[model samples]
Target: MVETSKVVVFQVGNEEYAIPIRFVISIEKVEGITPIPHLPDYMNGIFKVRGELIPVIDFERVLYQRPSNINELTKIIVIHTNELSLGVIVKDAKEIIDIPPEKIKQLGLIAYGKTSYFTGVANLDSRIITLIDPLKMVQSLDGIKQIQDFMAAEVNT
Candidate 1:
């Protein structure tokens, strides 16, 4: 049997990106940005959804090291990893694409440096879609520990 995977394509800034659909729980309109003091710039803030406070990350800022423009198309993607659940704001979501295992390509070292967030590349219609590794991207956050600690404190308080 062959294994197939799906990617959730989205836009950030002028570039297109995708993440494994398994990591994404849902996508919704951006909302409830409550800024926290002394937090890293990339950490947008926290938002309450379904009775849980989820941290919102500026995807553009994290990858491109610049602030993301907020427009009507801006949306929040809810992603859940084994240890954490958070939201990432993107310029827009394109569509989910099904990629056969054979269609996926391991990106070369040169391309990996330019797109560190991506785990590999998926080729479709002569166009390449970067597959972002959500764990790697989230681990790159400088203040993730702080956010975790803050959440713990909030629970205890």
Candidate 2:
């Protein structure tokens, strides 16, 4: 018996990215995101989910340092982790795919500098999808402390 990890494949511009399906809450249409003062451009802002407000982030901006194009194909993936819960805008929300341990490659030391957001790379058929750790991505930002403070101080008030 082999253990398999379920993952969701999504697009940021032309690049395909993946996250463990267990971290995903839902796939939703891009909604109105309320902008916050002093927030990073990649932070996008916050949106209401049920009664809770989740900060949204631009996947393209965070990973590629470019703004994500919001069009008909774009969607927001609501992801939750122990440290952060937020929506990530992706160009297209592709289907969920299973990644077996054998197909996933661990990142080497050379891949460490700028690829901190990605935990590993998944080879899914003909294409390779970089697996992003959304929580880590948020945690690594320069304004993360402020975002955390905002989330704690204002978001609930």
lDDT of 2 by residue, 22-52 (tens): 8899998888889887888789899888778
Model 1: how far residue 127 lies from native, Å: 2.7
Q: Which 10 consecutive residues of model 1 have the lowest summed lDDT?
A: 109-118
Quote the positional error of residue 121 for candidate 1 in Å.
0.8
Tens digits of per-residue lDDT, candidate 1, 52-139, equal 8888889999878998888889999999986588899999988998889888888775255545666777888867777888877777
Evaluated against the true structure, the overall lDDT of model 2 is: 0.84
Each candidate's clash count = 0, 0
User: Given candidate 1, what's the lDDT at residue 142?
Assistant: 84
lDDT computed for candidate 1: 0.83
What TM-score do all the candidates reach, one by one?
Answer: 0.90, 0.92
Residue 46 CA error for candidate 2 (Å)? 0.9
All-Cα superposition RMSD per candidate: 2.1, 1.6
Question: How well does candidate 1 match the true structure in TM-score terms?
Answer: 0.90
Residue-level lDDT for 131 in candidate 1: 83
